[model samples]
Target: MDSNWGSSSNLDSEWEEHRRQMMEEDEEDDARMRTNTQLTATAATLWTQEQIQQEGPWGGSVVGRSNKRRGRALGHQKLMMDYFVPNPIYTLENFRRRYRMRRHVFLHLVNDIPNVNPYFRQTTDATGNLGFSPHQKLTSALRMLAYASLADQINESMRMSESTSIENLGEFVVQLFTRTRMSTFDNQHMRT
Candidate 1:
């Protein structure tokens, strides 16, 4: 009975030692994980800072103070060749089908919208690069309205961002509605 009692106590001590070792290992693992997480976070922050310094304020290279160039000139050239130029690639019927309006009306809107809203007018960027033409902005807006398409959908063809597309749509709708409202009000006043 004395030997049995001694063996039982030894087993209990062994079990407690094993449990203590396991707990220590678990604490070491947790500490290692915390250190790894902190290192990863530091590396990410450094990378972001380096990227910001390289990209400057415009999300582009700092040397030119220009945003990432998307070949706007090439996009404009393609647009003109496709639909606006004399003897364009697409016929008038094709233009009408795509634009849901005649070429003349589209041109009129392109010409007139800039007068009402300066946003539609093309301007030079900080880097002396000409911005998008009124036609491009109007087309982007009209395409969204006509097709119920997302703004990014036109980026490949229109060479504008999703935000730009949405802005164009809002401006176009506001200006068109304002013009129509003013015209109607003026006619009503004249009749009265």
Candidate 2:
């Protein structure tokens, strides 16, 4: 019974020592957390201030850059008004026959058409030149787009509607040559 009491007293003292150690660990953890929190807050505030400084008052410099960019764009648009062809129809057969290239090579060229045409005719006069009205521009843009849509059918790239395809291709260059000869004959007859 005395030995049992002695062991209980020893356990009580050890438990008190363990409790003190736990309290010290808790204090250290809290101090570390508060320091981390303060550092995080300071970093965030500095970042916000730097952002404000770079942005300036009401983001005036950014607004100025955007306005200048817009003006340059408008100026480029104005330059497109001279020597612009409207909805220019490119005859693939004429290109193929003229260049004496294979049909497959011609198709590749045709695929490159839409991208090239816009750049070539981007700027023109309002009178159906490059600087088109909203509707004309839209139509021209559509024509440019149609090249890609029709590229599949063109030069046997893919199957497509036959009637529509023929019309889109326009008359063969041979026919144009024949018509030119006939017109020249008529002009010569009128001169006689």
Per-prediction TM-score to the true structure, in the order listed: 0.64, 0.32
RMSD values for the candidates in order, in angstroms, are: 23.0, 33.2
- Residue-level lDDT tens digits of model 2 in 1-192: 999999999999999999999999998997797566556445434544454455455512353343222232343344233222242243546434533554456345334443534422235433343332222222222232334234223323212222322322222222223444566579779999
- Indicate the residue-level lDDT of 118 in model 1: 96
Of candidate 2, the 10-residue stretch with the lowest lDDT total is 155-164
Model-by-model lDDT, in order?
A: 0.78, 0.41
Pull out the clashing pairs in model 1: none
lDDT for model 1, please.
0.78
The model with the greatest TM-score is 1
Model 2, residue 172: C-alpha shift (Å): 73
- For model 2, what is the error of residue 142's alpha carbon versus the real structure, in angstroms, after optimal superposition? 47
State residue 186's C-alpha deviation in candidate 1, in Å: 1.4
Model 2 misplacement above 4 A:
59-192
